[model samples]
Target: MTRMRIEGLLAAFPKLIGTGKQHTYVETENVRYVYQPMEALYLLLITNKQSNILEDLDTLRILSKLVPEYSYYFEESICKCAFDLILISLGHKENVTVAQVKQYCEMESHEEKLHRQMREDKIREAKDEMKRKANEIDKNKAIHVIYRL
Candidate 1:
């Protein structure tokens, strides 16, 4: 499904989920939300109605197991771990570990830092050029005023 629709459904999920004993799965007209509650958090899987419920549950089970192994604090960093987990789960990545994911995140962060530094350098160069042009303009104006006088 589209990202917006998925986000809409997820946004409405808490109301649909209710309190007390949670269900293993919740069904809508076109999608199913298979979730496993982890302490104060939830490990959710969104799948189409045509997909196999059993398989979805199994995937959720595996993810629920892996979540704890990768994250202990359930902070924002868990999002990156989730991405790696999804890649591994879909066979897009193989034999990956939490340490490997951390390395990958670090590499991405380093690249971003380099890009940011380059952008700053370019801005500084542009500002220097502007200042030089302004100074040249002021000198020309002074020379013209002296000649006119």
Candidate 2:
């Protein structure tokens, strides 16, 4: 869906939704807003009307659980840690630990290490070539001076 349409739905959402706790979803003409109301915030999943409601709700459930895990206070501060949350979510296969997340961020991949090593080797080789050329020039200059004598 377009950004304008999503924005229109979000703008209309407050008025469209009821104050009661009974409703979990609000449907529009072309879209479905499957949402879970958390304290002071809403965990919302917007999908096309043709999409499966059960799957959307399941995704919202997973997000609801994950959000609270990453952001405890459920305030604007959560936005600041959003990248870290995404990293933690994508970086782990099984249950994730803080140490594992830290390790994942800190550790270099094999390809990256290989590239760094190759770059260092090239720099060393360049320096060695410069030194060798300088030595050759000095020897030529010495031979020229002896020849002049």
Candidate 3:
């Protein structure tokens, strides 16, 4: 029975992870994307990119309380798509704890930092553009904003 179940999981793994257009276990809104562990992490990272004040290690402990299964499983399955099962199970859960919020914030911040440095690059870009416009008004020439050395 256990062997059959594991075999079933392997057979249905792709569809369960949303890899196929017509999955047996789930039919996503797009029905085109694959759902995997990294994808979950990526989503978590993307949604909380603006939170910079999160303390992830501590937050993980906090999240463990509200979602011990999720918290523990996430770390364990950080590299697999099996977390999708957890995602489905936890989908309707209400009222995530502050730690869960902080955990997501940390996830996003780490992801964003990997792509951008100096943190507030977007804000600096807008400021630099305004400065360039002011400079152009005075001299009628293009001004360059070199953010890096």
Candidate 4:
């Protein structure tokens, strides 16, 4: 089923090529294929048809720029490193632009933000636990005093 679905998406490429124009995408009823032609290969992304085309184009542009930096040449090694760059590119945004992807790839502020958030959460949890322990101590002290009286 998955293979057939992929093949169906790929089938549109020929028609787009036949149109005698440079084509970057094709939309089907269920999905959209955004493609980037490389020196020896083509990178294609299949997404829901309702997705933002501009963002998809921006992503394709970013990927095209990033791929060369990872492998220097198109091969399986590029695939291994692609995910790292992509996760960096996405940052905290639902829709990523090329500039954001570039900035993230360089600075990696997302990881810093994530670390800071985790630190804050841990501190908050520690404070809550300390308060609970203090309350328990107070309750035990009160009970002992009442027994003494």
What are the runs in model 3 whose C-alpha is more than 4 Å off? 1-109, 115-119, 140-149
lDDT of 2 by residue, 1-149 (tens): 57797688878877777887687999988778889888876777776788777766766766676666667666666655543334324423345445565566578999999999999999999999999999999999999999999
- Tell me model 3's lDDT, rounded to 2 decimals: 0.43
Candidate 3 per-residue lDDT, tens place, 43-100, comes to 2211122222233223333433434345556545655534421222242334456665
Give a tens-digit lDDT track for model 4, residues 51-124: 78887787787778777665765666655554434353343326665576667667857779999999999999
Clashing residue pairs for model 1: none
TM-scores for candidates 1 onward, in order: 0.53, 0.52, 0.22, 0.47
Worst 10 residues of 2 by lDDT: 84-93
Q: Better model by lDDT, 1 or 4?
A: 1
| CA-lDDT, candidates in order | 0.74, 0.74, 0.43, 0.72
Q: Can you give the lDDT of residue 49 in candidate 4?
A: 81
Two-way TM-score contest, 1 vs 3, winner: 1
Clash pairs (backbone) in predicted model 3 = none
Q: Which stretches of candidate 4 lie above 4 Å from their native place?
A: 1-19, 75-149
Better of 1 and 4 by TM-score: 1
